[model samples]
Target: MMNDESLICEETANFTLGNTFYRSQSKITRDLGVLAAKIYKSEQGRLRVLDAMTGCGVRSIRYYLESDADFIWSNDSNPENKAVIEYNLGFILQKNKGKITYKNANNIFFECFNNKDYYDFVDVDAFGSPNPYLSTVLWATKINGLIYVTCTDGRTGTGHLPENCLQNYGSYGRSHPAAQEQVLRLIIGSSLQEAATMGLGIEPIFAYFSGSTYRVMLRLLPKINLSLDNYGFLGYCHHCGEYTTISYKQLGKVNCYHQQENKYYNYTISGAMWLGNLHNKEYLKTMKNLAISLKWSTVSDLLSIMIHESNFPPYFYTLGEIGRRGKLDIPKRSQLIEALENDGFQATNTHINSQAIKTNASLKQCIEISEKLINNSKVGKIND
Candidate 1:
């Protein structure tokens, strides 16, 4: 039992009563709060929300208190967590007249199966990779409903060896920034594929990375008249740096390069590179707006970095302006190429009108380039 003194604080009072609840809220949760608040304030209709693996019901409670969600269902497999959820909802129920339900079940798989009702918004916050619960969440969500997912298995999902991630997620890839982004996308894609098998379609609307966690928000769209199984994976050799992009149907083979050549070899095939741009313009706009509203400086900084490197226009700009403008004012195309070379990024300007650049470097050269860009302060801003 939580001590009585622990219950008296304002912060503690806002959360569910339990030893298993999160000690401090995560950035992902806080960001979710901002998005949920926006959705609640914008939409006038009744909203039904669910928090699978509610633990101490921090997410569910936030929705109850801050949003117009008519009903909030909080569930956890642990009895103690359920009890704490009940304790936390007491004050919320009294103040907002909101309906809160607490249930005990294996939320990783079974809770959605038992619940007959479909929710407008479903939040899944599992302790690790959320792969186990994707099917259930898909089933229990209403068509066109929003689903928020948090994957906490960063060490294995996003940060692990590419081969290890492939072995676990049935998709493989390296742990570079692009690869990490793809891993999260692959996990979501796998879930969407499963849902598609059941005649469902999901449109991912937002995704972002926070410390050790990748959160994605998707909307379950109606089953459009189309087949969804036209995606595949890419395998890359870590030793020789050779890459092969192949479909799921072509993934069965046994080749032991180590046994044949007596050298250490590793490769990863990941599911997230879905052969398309993951974020559409609308989604990017929403993310930009959310970032601005929340004053997320790091996200802004990363956006700037990505824009400078990719030579893409600002998120808020129109395509016409992007095209009509001869060049972006922030980063000269040539400077970006040089920066990419200095940072060891395999970048080449494929712009038909621009010059192409490529590099082949030894391991030592790659290390030096990386260190020079990341460690040395003398490399002034490329955009400047």
Candidate 2:
């Protein structure tokens, strides 16, 4: 009964999703993207964007309406979506503010490069691995421009598929308690590696995980930023539940200190991934201020957590892991964080995992602290 004449409309933020593929759950990411784009525009004095996977053209509409993008090029491979995209972005198209194209994403990127039409911002909302566009998108991105790349392939990135991880991220992935966080780091590291191939570097503007999806916004630099310290591996001890950074030179030396009698343990090393700060604190602070000005309380709160956990290690320990390792009941996340903080260990909640904590303290230290807190609670109850 449905035909091309049938009109379908949905609303998100300030735009209408016109008969195109739309996911309501992805609105938060679009919101964050709009905020980041607005901030980029304010600082650079102009904003031209290339939405490589425009879908229903919602993002293009938001970029134009919310971020005040000077120009936007929205592309989707499905020619059938052209009418919907145009319908959604009609106003912008009529005003010469944007263009719509039906072409493969890589073809679009190649075209941009061939025509020397670089964008100040490029958003690639890729399904599964973002590896395909990781290197190609840079060709369309201006130096110091922002690239918002996304990956929904949790299985591959989380180490459930080692072969796929290597093929996609160019790194080994291993399943661990903190594998979700590892997905974010893998994307950043892979992006860095791709950029380095072009004699360019990237700085992490922000790294975000929205439950199942992993996203990282990076600023392309004119120089290469790949080095031993920042581009490295992570060694997680299966025996003791500890995490440590491993450089390229230290690959053969990855031995866990958690020795049993005379037996030294080997760590499950996962990397050739990013070991750098996940978010730029100053930039996140600026984003938070913008969120505050807009009265977006939820966004502000999330940004606050991201800023706090930015300086911690690349991995986090879930309360479940701490409990299992200690042979005790799962400690309350809030109480554990409080105890860790009081004991001079910098511990905070990670937005990546609600039940986890990012801290400078070791897993053993965390377990010990949890025991003391639980015991103290018992003693207080007895006295009462």
TM-scores of all models? 0.64, 0.96
Which stretches of candidate 1 lie above 4 Å from their native place?
1-13, 16-18, 23-25, 40-44, 95-116, 158-168, 172-178, 224-230, 237-268, 290-384
For model 2, how many clashes?
0
Question: Which portions of model 2 miss their true places by more than 4 Å?
Answer: 1-19
* Per-residue lDDT value at 54 in model 2: 93
Q: What is the number of backbone collisions in each predicted candidate, taken in the order shown?
A: 7, 0
Report the error of model 1 at residue 382, Å.
19
Best by TM-score: 2
Candidate 2, residue 183: how far the Cα is off, in Å: 0.9
Write the residue-wise lDDT of candidate 1 on 1-384 in tens digits. 544455523222365355775745374454444454456445537677777667776666666655556777776766645566677776666765445444532443354556667777878876677776666778777777787877877667554665666655666545532344555566667666667778877676555555566776777778832232335655555554333445656665523265457875544665544443343444445545666665766554443333232322101111122222323223344454476565655543321122222223322333334345443433555534
Worst 10 residues of 1 by lDDT: 312-321
lDDT of each: 0.54, 0.89
TM-score, prediction 2: 0.96
Query: Cα RMSD to native, each candidate?
Result: 10.0, 2.2
